[model samples]
Target chain A: MKKVHILNYGLGNVFSLYNAIKYKHGNVNLLNKKQNFNDVEILFIPGVGSFNQAMNILNRDFKKLLIHLNSNKIKIVGICLGHHLLFTEGDEGGACSGLGLINGKIKLLKKRNSSDVLPNIGWREIKLKSPKLSIFKKYDKHKFYFCHSYFSKLKYSNQSVFSSSYCHNEFSCMVYDENIFGLQFHPEKSREIGLELINDIIRY
Target chain B: MIQRIIGRIDIKNEFVIKGINFEGLRKIGDPIEIAQKFYEYKLDEIFIYDAVASLYGRNSLFELIKKITKEIFIPVCLSGGIRSLKDIERALLSGADKVGLNSAIVKNPKLLKKASKVFGLSNIVATIEAKKKTDTYWEIYINNGRDQTGISLIDWINKVQDYGCGEIILSSIDRDGTLKGFDLDLINFVSKRSKINVPLILSGGCSNYNDIINLKKKHKSVSCAIASALHYNKINKKDFLKR
Candidate 1:
């Protein structure tokens, strides 16, 4: 079994991700200030706040550790705001630099019309762009819970495993670049399908 | 966008309870058990509101949320007694996806702006417990609908959006637990009057499948939160996804 570690900075709901992993894997640990990634097989960046705020924390605390993890080829998963952080920059909460693991920039989701709401909340379906990818082969057109005002724009379209449409704006909902994976939706909060997806990621 | 069916579990002293117009409470079951059942039913979301948290001046739902989110893998929105940023932080750390504010925001409107900035707008939900004041107007209520704030429903709805709340849970005090069907007039009135661009979660007075269907037919973009109907199994969970 792979050892899973969830980054627990003073932002977002870390416990939900921890509990989700512990429920199935039972070998999850929260990577806090005193922790090191020496034994971590999988590192999860669980976040639910503004990109600039989260980026500031990551830049201050985990920059070197993240570089080390990336170079070591350790599997890294980013959820929601954490997914936004995988890009080169984000416009949320003013412009800020990200981890730059993937080539992209995060921008506010444009409204298609007056009726479209900001911070698109609730469940929506994802269209699998790379259905041949093993992790997402069975999840085409599956609805996952999404709650964010911003969306990711990747430089390389091939990095996006799944794309979803919201407010008439098509954005990457799931992306994978080598060992780094990013999900704009909260899989931990997406019920059975989400749980199965998490398990699949862990197994992969 | 899909019309979501949310299970609303009203908690009073750690026990899931239901009532008419937010009064005459009757205990239903444990919060954990009720939340687990909702998750099993594959409801789009779970709303856990501590009925007495604001009146008592402390939130007791944190521990309950910790236990519920441990196994339930669905989004959980918690309300009642969220007064400060610290309270919001504690709720999120305990595994809540969103924190709903009612009485606290009524006391300090700026807190909504501050909380939304610190926690991100989507993580903050504004809960409006409303009662019909006139044929065309509704008034906002707080402290479990026991106290009234002079703020009009439409005005507050607009202001809440401006203040940066991502979603609104509009509960009708007259229709809550009545099983009479949703306050269609109230929903229509607000929809027409308020400049609301956020996702609205309509609560109260959903008795059967027809009520939900009717609401969905009329309002294509909104979601509904069911309490009495779901708690008593008046409607099948499968029916929620139908249509």
Candidate 2:
């Protein structure tokens, strides 16, 4: 049985994702120590806060451990802020640097036109391009839950495997290349359909 | 214009619907059943929110959503237990037309921006949770009203709008389920502070038609929201429809 490791940068919500994944994926562990990665075949970074703060903590506390682990070629999934931090540069407030996993600079939502709405909150549908995506391996036909203000027009090594559209742009939902993965939404909280996505990730 | 009739649901867990005013009203009545019923009545929309969504790290009521969304023809807005992009995506996949996020937006203002980009402006409804301060200002509270951010009612609305909420659901926690009357001062403060004019639905303090009437007059024909009064049947929809 493979165990999954969730990064605990003190942003809270670690247990929720843990419970969700555990409920579905079987074996799960709260990543308190970087050495925990030795056993974790998959890693998860889940949160709801400033990306700068979340990454800073990881760098300051884990430092050498994360750099070493990235080279292991094991799968690492970044969610929300976790996804943004994977980028090389984030334009939030200033040029706040990130984990430098992807190439694009993260920035605020493009301001909407007068008739166009802002803070596109709500259950919007993603026009997923990859029917073959492992996350959607088991399920299809529906929208995903969403709540965020900034997105990284990702500059990752691989192309965006899945996508969701808003205002006038189609943003990446799942991006992957080799071992690095980033999800713009929380699969843990997505219910059974969300669980199906998780099942795909674990099996992958 | 067909004014939106948004139903407010306060969930505790998978099955708990909290109504402080109507004792014994708390039970596991299927929210989907309620949402479907609203659709039958031609309600414009439905908002299923978690008053204590984050406290327990509750997942979206996907079971209920899976059922209701399949049946109901109208758009459904799921709130509560929503704090991030994942929560929003989960709600949408469960058949929600929109995600109503209250405290989550206040905590991570950036979430609005991220969600808007991913989903579009119409899909996200920013729920503003308020507690009356003095008589004029309604202080904003977050984390299920456990902590007072000390951000003024006016400032919170302005900032959240700047954050890019397509619509605002302004609910008064103190006045929730009371059926007294909608808080005009609170509604007024938010409306005046807002420059974008996204839809603002007033919740709490609705006991009769006059409250809506009073609120309308107070805001000079501006419409507002009333949940408990409608839920508990304190006022007839005919009265307002005729007005």
Candidate 3:
């Protein structure tokens, strides 16, 4: 079984993500400020809740820990709000600095037409641009559960950027740069298909 | 947009139960077993309402929810007795993705604003239980349809949206548990008048696949939540897979 560390910043659906990983028989550990990450192989950031509140509670220790992980080239995964927070800054609640792992900003979804709903909640498809990448090698067409108002707007497109879709308009759905990765959908909540993707990533 | 087929579970004292028009309650099955079955059958979401939580002054389903969350992977919404921000916090922390409010929000409307601000708009669901009063109007019922609020259903729908709720679950008290099909007239009225700009989940009735298909054909924007039809096996997994 793969061993992983999940950052528990006092919010988000950490329990669901924890259960999802554990259900796949992965040995999971919840990381807090006082915890050490010497045994951590993969760092999973599950998404939910407010961006500002999550940022406010990060404290100095967790901030340093994440920066240290980034410098060490440790494999990191961010989901939804967690994905957005990988950027340099976020605008949810108010303008706040992020972990600066990605070159972008978080913006709210704008309605192209009046019929579009905010906080787009439901199962939607994410067309993969990099199918050969280990994370998305299994499927051609993928549909995952999404419930968020804000998304990551990549500043530039590189080969590492894997997927994109139009909720209101085009937005980055998945990003992979070296040891860093991000998914804007809830894999843990996406049922069997999602679990397969998660298991693939963990095994890889 | 694909219309979601959701399973609605009403629980009292840990056992899943259902009642006609929200009265004459009786046991149905274990909440955990029913939830796991629904998950395996591929229900879009599961909504657990504690019908007697307020009367007891505590959300007794917290432990039950923690257990369910471990086995079920999809989103779950818990309702009943959520009167304050702390209650909403505890519910979300207890593993519910969304918290549904009815009598508490109807009594203290600002609770909607505070809860939305603290939990974010997407996490709050406003529940409206409506009963037909006349040929053209329905009255809003509270306390699980035991008391009528004398508030026009349309006006209350607008009010909850104005107060900043992200979604509305409009359950018709007249057709609940009857499985005759949804109250079409009531649903059409809300579909036409609601400018809330959130997903609308219509509950109560829904006996078969045709009822859901007809609802989708008529109201493309709304989703249906079935209880008795799903609980009694009136509708099967194949029916949902056909769509």
Candidate 4:
């Protein structure tokens, strides 16, 4: 059984992700402060609130601890705003610094045509560029529920597994560079396929 | 784009209840059980409304919503008597993914702006209960469809979107709980007139699969919320998915 630590930083609905892991029968714990990172086999950062507000709540010591945890070779999975937090910076709520776990910056999903709504709130299919990757093989060409206005634009590489093109722009939906993974969609809210993928990630 | 099938549960005093035309309420079962059942049926979303939250001057769906979110993995939308920013905070803390506002937003349209600013646009949903008044006009109703606000459906839609509501859930009070089918004319009229780019969810009077599919076909952007038809087992997931 993998030991999971879910960071509840007073932003977003952490319990949804908490229950998601619990539903998969994974051993999960909620880490609220900087000191609770011990024995964390899998570090999960889940978020759904404003980026600037979330960044404000993450204390300086905790930010340092995140880097320390990453250096310890702990597998980290970021969901939604959690995924945005891994970037070098974010423009939501008037620009804020992110955790800088990944080499990317967050930008608002540009409203291209009249049909594209801001905050892209609905289910969208992810076009997998690397279909052979075991971590995302099941979700290749499958739709996942997304509810965010901002997305990350990283330097494209073979490490980027999936992408969703919307509003005349494209953003990375699944980014994996070594042991770290970030998902822009809410797998817990995405029904069965999402749950299955989450289970596989936890066990992997 | 894939349209969603939303299972709506109306609760009165912690019991899941349903009524016709927003009257003659009858308890169906526990909200937790019904919500779990909806999840089992693979409904895309679950909408929970406290049918009489305003009448009692409080929100009674907090614990019910918390319990539902623990077991159900899908998004749960909570509405009814949501007045202040604190109410939105409490509901979100209690596990509601999105907070739906009705009487509260109607009373003070500014509430929409404030809530959206704090909770972000995507987390705030404005639920409009519109009753058909004439051939081309539908008036918005508040307080569980009992009180008429004399506000035109189009006007309310425009206002809420300006206030930054992420989604507009349009419930036809005239067709609610009737199992006759949605008011396609009303939906078509509103969808055409509205300038907002957010998703518009149509609710009330869903009887069969065709009704759901037809709404998707005619209006490519809207989602449908079903209650009576699904509660009574008149329509199932297979019926909606079958081409």
Candidate 4: regions farther than 4 A off: A59-61, B241-243
What does candidate 3's lDDT look like per residue over B88-193, in tens digits? 7777767788899998988889999888776778889998899998877889988788888889998998888888877889999999998889989898776676
- Chain A TM-score, structure 3: 0.91
Q: Best candidate per TM-score, number?
A: 1
In candidate 1 chain A, what residue range of length 10 has the lowest lDDT sum? A128-137
For model 1, the DockQ equals 0.80
Quality class of the docking in candidate 4, CAPRI style: medium
- Clash tally, candidates in order: 0, 34, 0, 0
Location of the lowest summed lDDT over 10 successive residues in candidate 4 chain A: A59-68
Top lDDT hit? 1
lDDT per residue (tens digit) for residues A52-131 in model 3: 77777664558777877888888888988778778888998889998888888888888776666666777777776665
Local error of candidate 4 at residue B11 (angstroms):
1.0
lDDT tens per residue, model 2, A1-204: 777888877534454466567667778876775454567688888755566666667888877657766888777888777777777887765678888776777777665554343444434455555655555544444555555667778664246777776666567777776777777766654545666677677778
lDDT of 3 at A99: 81
TM-score of 3: 0.93
Q: For candidate 1, write residues B126-147 as lDDT tens digits.
A: 9999999898779999999999
| Candidate 1 CAPRI level | high
Q: In model 3 chain A, where is the ten-residue run with the lowest total lDDT? A: A159-168
Chain A TM-score values, per prediction: 0.97, 0.88, 0.91, 0.92
Q: Which model is ahead, 1 or 3, in terms of TM-score?
A: 1
Which of candidates 3 and 4 reaches a greater lDDT? 4
Global local distance difference test of model 4: 0.83
Off by more than 4 A, model 3 = A59-61, A132-135, A159-168
